[model samples]
Target: MFNDEPGDNETFLYKLERESEVQKLIAHLKRSKKTYVRRRAATMLGNIAEISDPNERRQAVKALVSAIKTDEDDSVRAAAIDALYQRGEDAFDYLVAEIAEMGGSEATERTATTLLTEWLSADHLEFRMVAATALGERGATAAVPDLVRALTDPAPRVRTRAAQACGRLSDPRVVPPLSERLSDGRQQVREAAANALGAIGTDRALAELVPVTQADEEGLRLIAVDELGQFGSVKPVVVLVDALDDDSTTVQRAAMLSLLELLTTASTEELELICGTVVDELARADIQATVPALLDIAADGTRRRYRQTAIWLLSRITGDRYRSEVIDCLLPAIDKPDEETAQLAEAVLPELRSPELEKRLRVYLSRERGSEEARSRAQAVLDEICDGSSGELVTTGVDYTYVDSPADYTNQHSSRD
Candidate 1:
């Protein structure tokens, strides 16, 4: 089927399939324009492996078999297994053929390790990674030693891929090596470790990772928290809640967001406790990552209600002085432009305003990049300053006292809402 837009052979094959022209598609797929196109065509054919035309099926299968050996993309070629899933006895032949073609050193060892070792010596990083992944996925535990060795590959991508492939096999023996990698200097490597540990999912893996939540570096701890959240349960929740008291606001915020995500599955009481620290759980959990505010909260946040609860808890745990500091600490939120900060006064039951702290009087009327939200906030503060003292123009701090009864901060603070 000729089309207006010229594309690689895969696009033509897809077009032909839509037209229910399977027989002709199979023939053209064999002599593709390029190796990449040939592989994609094979993948689509595998998707429709049950095509009624026997001759067409044979031709598609032939193309797939050729791809298994010749095509460069191991991932696309790997689809053969899925294609053979229901084919039963016939599929068995394809599987055995792949294994035989890959495994050259007969009686002593299986898999493509011998060939792969030879390939690796020649700096074929892509093939080495692909072979390691395929071997591991194929349940060739014998490849674990080779896969682990790939962790030291000069190419970080290869090492990263190898770490992940090792996780897929989930062999106990790889745990020690993977554990050692828990503190890999590379960010990707460290993240990959958390992934491998998650895959391992052993009691040891859980124990090792729980402590990672408290790691001093924000990045590592974030990854650890993220991985732990994957194992979602009240225990991880409790651990995260405890982290809310950590010195780093970043850790506290991750704990809150993860805690919020946990709310999707947590009991109402737990969420209510979280509300005590951050009144804006939903705001903090925004996945759009649209603006810096979202990213800022996603990093480390002091959700107003959550902060209040933390203060209350601190007062109970430590004392009144720390509680005052917690309240004072809220200055950061009050001066910011966010819904979470806006509703905090009512939620926390404490009415405090930044009178001398430049008040952002203007509201963002609309939520867009160029909106006057920031300017409006600035104007509100400036207007208040001007109204309080007309004779002299003051530019420093804006007067933030309630227009009516400043003491009743909740009603005053909530007037806009």
Candidate 2:
């Protein structure tokens, strides 16, 4: 058996199949004079609540709950509460009753909230953070006001937990105060605040989140960008697009994912408008840097339209020099069963024309694995670029219309549909 020294709940509870261990620990809880021994005993009892016999588990829980209310040692009391936390909903009522008893009232409407409030005000920061978390786990709306108040606690740890509790409570009234914390002096608190607002999910929450996307701190900006992306509104598209250039690779990758989410249901006109931002970036020679991120989207076959649209957008951004890179990724996609992917690749292939691309197309045409229509479309693009005799590449099975640049995409900016 692993030594039950101090906080080793893992080892003490690891092999509890033997009833002797349970009897010994339960006896320790009853008779041990040392607070640390009794605390670990309480922790082990809670940990075994799942594996112990039904009668034994119930007895252990009852003992732990009693200890939580009466233990003189603060660590013992905290450990009992944490162990009960492991038991989940089974322990909620006992904890609530303990709160009522602690507050000296079962009749008060705010007994749970009141108990937690006192805990949050405790002089010790660790206790304050624990109380903030317990209030969140309780998931009571009445606790929102208290948690919001705790958001500005002098200790950053308390503020961070308070912000998290606000997210779990998901009360709209908490949005205003949580929004203020987006600019909190501490980065962890700011990130937590942004996440809390995202959970609240009110229109106002999204509006408040937009500004944090521009925050100087990369951690806050990353959270704000991720939360803003969930709204899928074009309003934050420009901000998300700007995040594509954030110096942190993590932030840049996050921005690309958000952009993909925004584009998933966007219309042709919306695509034009969103991709139009990339066009402006292209003007500044900034678009080429995103080639790797865009290729990630193109290669992710699970996101079919996203992959197709990414391939199309990449063809526009990369030009002939990246012709081989674009073709290498898209060529395999042409034979995919999803017709949208095949069609999109066929459309993009015309734009990526070069003698090297021509040779690859010829190879694909000769292969028996591709759909005949795909082969025919490949032949058409080959003819347009290789033969230099084209008004436009037309195939019966797929449209190989050359994707024009800004004009084709930008001209539709006025039409939302």
Candidate 3:
């Protein structure tokens, strides 16, 4: 028997005396046969928990906790959790403990995830953060929408937790919202978004992270590059290649390492195709800046075909800018146990023919410290340059038409199938 007066805005504690009204609500919450009645009782107890009377607040909390533990209806249990949540810190602690305890059962786990999803909108920041964390830990895919919305919470910590939760869920649906967070004013939120985009590891998700690779923040760029390594896609690999020229040497190193990590996963054919696309798209100056990374790949690359592609890219892109360094990388490969690497180096060397390259090869040949195989390779490449037959060979299989400008190249390629 509860009061049903219309337009009565007085607090529940004052409208109905503490002992009588509270006892009735608790009885209905625990023993009511009707589901709606129990739901309403649970809600009232939550409102009552906000009252200043300590004894009444504890009684309300105890009733809600009982409803959570014993209520047969999911809605009733959810209502009880929401009610207990309003009881402040002590009840919130009890609520968390009860959810953890209930988590052992599949049905209760669903109920807990649903309730936590609703808590994402709670006025209290702690509730939002804890709910996000719990949903992520539970791997609640159903909570993704709420988590995405929470990505824009006024509090940076809430946004960070929500981004992390979205990542843990690994749902593609969160990709766009996470992308928006990449530019969040807060660095931690941006980093979390980048990390989440990487964790999702979908093409769309990985694509969202590309812009972040150019972020002004070095740490953010480092995170973007590192996460891109987890995915073995052409886009991320190409992005990593470009990152090789980053102003920050630390980023440059990370880009190189991520490129190597990608090699371990991406197929040889994929790397070769991406390498060709990279060569076609990158401006001459940008290509030149990548020499160090390309050399690193040429030296420590895992697959023979990829290493050869790296060498080919080095030849095509370097032109004459970093010829000395390119020669240094190639000469060592020529002496390695892998014959394909040796042959690729030897083939691409003649294409790199220049007075400078010729002089380097001659100097290399004169040095007794060089490996015999390396010296022999150098001799052959040097003879090609001197005999005036160096530039005749098309070592790189891709046909090249020189464009006056990068814009011309882009327009030509864009028009092609």
Candidate 3 lDDT by residue in tens digits, 54-168: 7877777887877766777666776777676565667856665555454667887888787788778877665676688677777889888889889999989789989988998
TM-score of each: 0.38, 0.66, 0.55
lDDT of 1 by residue, 1-417 (tens): 212233545566677656656556455445554545544454456566357767766665666666556655454455443344334446535544464356445643443556554433334454454555455555667768877887777866567767887788888887778777777778787778777877776656755678777666777777666656544345565566566655666666666556555544445666565444433322233222212222344224555434433322322222232333433343333334565543342233133223322221221112221234434443444445456553134344554442323565677667768
Model 1 residue runs over 4 Å out of place are 1-122, 215-219, 229-239, 245-417
Better of 1 and 2 by lDDT: 2
Task: Give the candidate order by descending lDDT.
Answer: 3, 2, 1
Prediction-by-prediction clash tally: 15, 0, 0
Best by TM-score: 2
RMSD of 2: 11.1
Q: Which wins on TM-score, candidate 2 or candidate 3?
A: 2
Error of 2 at 125 (Å): 5.0
- How large an RMSD does model 3 have? 16.0
Q: Could you report the Cα RMSD, in angstroms, for every candidate shown? A: 15.2, 11.1, 16.0
For all candidates in order, the CA lDDT equals 0.52, 0.72, 0.74
14 Cα displacement, candidate 3 (Å)? 40
